[model samples]
Target: MESKLSRNEAISQLVLASSSPRRKELVASLDLSLPVYILSTDTDESIEAHWSPEQVVEQLSLRKANAALDLLQQKQAVETSLIIGADTIVVLDGDVLGKPVDDDEAKAMLRRLQGRAHEVYTGIACVLSSSGEAQLAHRMTKVKMKPLSEEQIARYVATGEPRDKAGSYGIQGLGSTLVDEIEGCYFNVVGLPLSLLSDMLATYDIAVF
Candidate 1:
């Protein structure tokens, strides 16, 4: 069989401008042989607290991509590199919930989500350093959480699994038990939307099987 990457010229590196392990795993699933570079940009995500969820994520993703592109340009190692930046946020009743600051905060977030449907928005941006072109896309998934008792929330919070995740839950981890149903891309809830990402990458001559 011919290689999926055969149509594209080889990339010097695939730079991921986020510190998310879930994003890394999703990208690795593409099975590309290029080196993976994890570059976390210190972009401030403090928005006006009034932007829509989709707008918030897309803006953050773009900022991250631009920051990484600037860094690559400064280093002058600007060979053919594709930088992928992503941002995920949980929206409940028009409020954006990011990672929790404490166990109490996590528990509170989970309690609010219990028996409620929320939206998970993930923004993806790909920048081609050689061409200075970037593409940004956002995916939103409606996720319903199963009703959880106080004991259940306490037990789950004690596991310390929700502290580092948006909406105080990790859909791919132990938090999966709290999910009742999902109405869109499961990978988007996890952090990245693989199908949409594949389509986006294809525009840059990168194919994903």
Candidate 2:
């Protein structure tokens, strides 16, 4: 456990290493009461293509965090900031589905996921810039999509909400209507996992409350 921050010093320096708007919104709502700084890192997301979903998310999350930290150091901007990096992926039948590259690919991913259950795995990493100390973790959520007719899928796809999302769905947006039930962290499917994030921050002298 870390020492609690004083109200006078409560607004800790934070760097979120992600380009994801969904993740930025989710983290903002936590109200860590810190001076949050959002960073969009263009980290290489490619992997071996054969790694398990868990392994892939974990490695990618760490890479994003480290990449952001490196950038900060290069700029000599922040040495004591708490850095966060994360990645989310949809897995079905052992295949990892990342953000779709185009409308057609998004449609194909949605077509395959409809009327079926899939897993959303989100990996999170927290690193202290000063000490290079870090902790990493991941959460898995089971999401079951409602059976949709060709018309329903086509209409949803036409709306373009699925274009940039994994598995061609955004649970926090129009895609909510497509999910029948979810068996894990709701935020994980939305792009970040709050409970998992809160727990990780505890080690860095930050508290969500």
Candidate 3:
């Protein structure tokens, strides 16, 4: 069998502008065998309260990608690297939910989401350092959570799985049991939308098997 890396030209040397282990794992699962260089961008994600969730994610992703590009330039590495940056946010009833600040915050988020459908929006940005061209896109997934009793929320919070994740939950981890259904790309909820990322990469002559 051919090596997975040999099957695609577009993703052979992709850089991931994130430190998210979940995003890394999701990209690796594509079997592309590409080297992922993690360069966390120091971009402020605070958006105007009036901005929609989709817009917030998109802007953040672009900011991250640009920051990574600047870092690459400072390193004076070869200018052919393709950098990918992504951001995800959870939205409930027009409110943007980010990582929980504390255990109590996580519990509150879970309580608000209990037995309700919320939207998960993931924004992706791809930049070609040499050409200075970039592509941006957003993917939204609707997820329904099963009703959780007070005890359930407290128990889950104790596990500490929801502290570092948006909306205080991680669908790919212990939080999976809380999700009743998903209406779109499962990977999007996990962190990055591989299908959409692949599509965007393809535009730059990158391919994934």
lDDT of each: 0.88, 0.86, 0.86
lDDT of 1 by residue, 60-107 (tens): 998898899889888998478888989999999988999999999999
Following a full C-alpha superposition, what root-mean-square deviation does model 2 have from the true structure?
3.0
Model 3, 1-209: lDDT tens digits are 23434333343477889989998887787766557678887788789878888788988998899899999899997737788899999999999999999999999999999999999999998877775577789999999999999999999999999988999999998999999999999999999998898887666656586
Q: Specify the poorest-scoring 10-residue window by lDDT in model 2.
A: 2-11
User: Which candidate's TM-score is highest?
Assistant: 2
CA RMSD of each candidate after superposition: 4.0, 3.0, 4.8
Q: Estimate the overall C-alpha local distance difference test score of candidate 1.
A: 0.88
Best by lDDT: 1
Measured with C-alpha atoms, the lDDT of residue 67 in candidate 3 is 92
Model 3 clashing residue pairs (backbone): 10-206, 10-207
TM-score of each: 0.91, 0.92, 0.91
Question: Candidate 2, residues 1-209: lDDT per residue as tens digits?
Answer: 34444211332588999888888998899987777888888899998867888889988998999999999899997447888999999999998999999888887888899899999999998877876666789999999998888888889989989888888989999999999999999999998999999977776557798
Native-to-model Cα distance after best TM-score fit, residue 134 in candidate 2, in Å? 2.4
Instruction: Judge candidate 3 against the unseen true structure and give its global Cα lDDT, from 0 to 1.
Output: 0.86
Clashes of each: 0, 0, 2
Q: Residue pairs in steric clash, candidate 1?
A: none
Model with the higher lDDT, candidate 1 or 2: 1
